[model samples]
Target: MQTTPEHDERMAKMTFASVYPHYVSKVERKGRTKEELHAVIFWLTGFDDQALQRLIDEKATFQDFFDQSNLNANAHLITGVICGYRIEEISNPLTQKVRYLDKLVDELAKGRKMEKILRA
Candidate 1:
């Protein structure tokens, strides 16, 4: 059977909610905000307003959307989208995870155990 472009487009239009009803309900029960829901949809299938709205109407939650989005397939893109979306939610302004590494080194000079110093 020959597949038409229209058929492909039609299939593409189907949202994750329609494909995974059980997971969608689980996401809604988790109390995910609309922005988070959108982020997940955007992460998964790119941006499609109609599809996204359908998922929202079907009660798609953050976890549901995340689960459907194959983040591993496009890790960098997904990470960028999620981080950009939640940038404001980060309370700490520290740029690095090891912000106090320098301080730890200074303390270690005073005879602190290497394990204890590293853990600080």
Candidate 2:
């Protein structure tokens, strides 16, 4: 099966490490902390601190990164509009998953509590 090029460009082929700094910056600039950002990603992906660092250092592609993830069951609880797309309504499965992570990080940057962001 083939995935969309738009999806490939938007996120599929992007390296997690390449985009990670921006995530840290976005949250820290908003008065949040890197720990919170890490926590969000960890919660979503089931990666511990060591595993996440390893993935980043390896420059894993978004597809590779997610392929290694044991996505949390509660991830389905993440919903709402992001970047003009309704999270739950995204047609392409990979795009929807990527957007789900993006939406969580966005919420963290916007100052939502970690527990709430984790859907706890």
For this target, which candidate reaches the highest lDDT against the unseen true structure? 2
Error of 2 at 116 (Å): 1.1
The most accurate candidate by TM-score is 2
**Per-residue lDDT of candidate 1, residues 86-115 (tens digit):** 322323322111112223223333444544
Global Cα RMSD, each model: 18.6, 2.8
Cα shift from native, residue 50, model 2 (Å): 0.9
Once fitted onto the true fold, the runs of candidate 1 whose alpha carbons sit more than 4 angstroms away are: 1-17, 51-73, 76-120
After superposition, which runs of candidate 2 have C-alpha atoms over 4 Å from their true positions? Answer: 1-5, 8-10
Each prediction's whole-model lDDT (CA) = 0.38, 0.87
Point out the worst 10-residue segment of candidate 2 by lDDT.
1-10
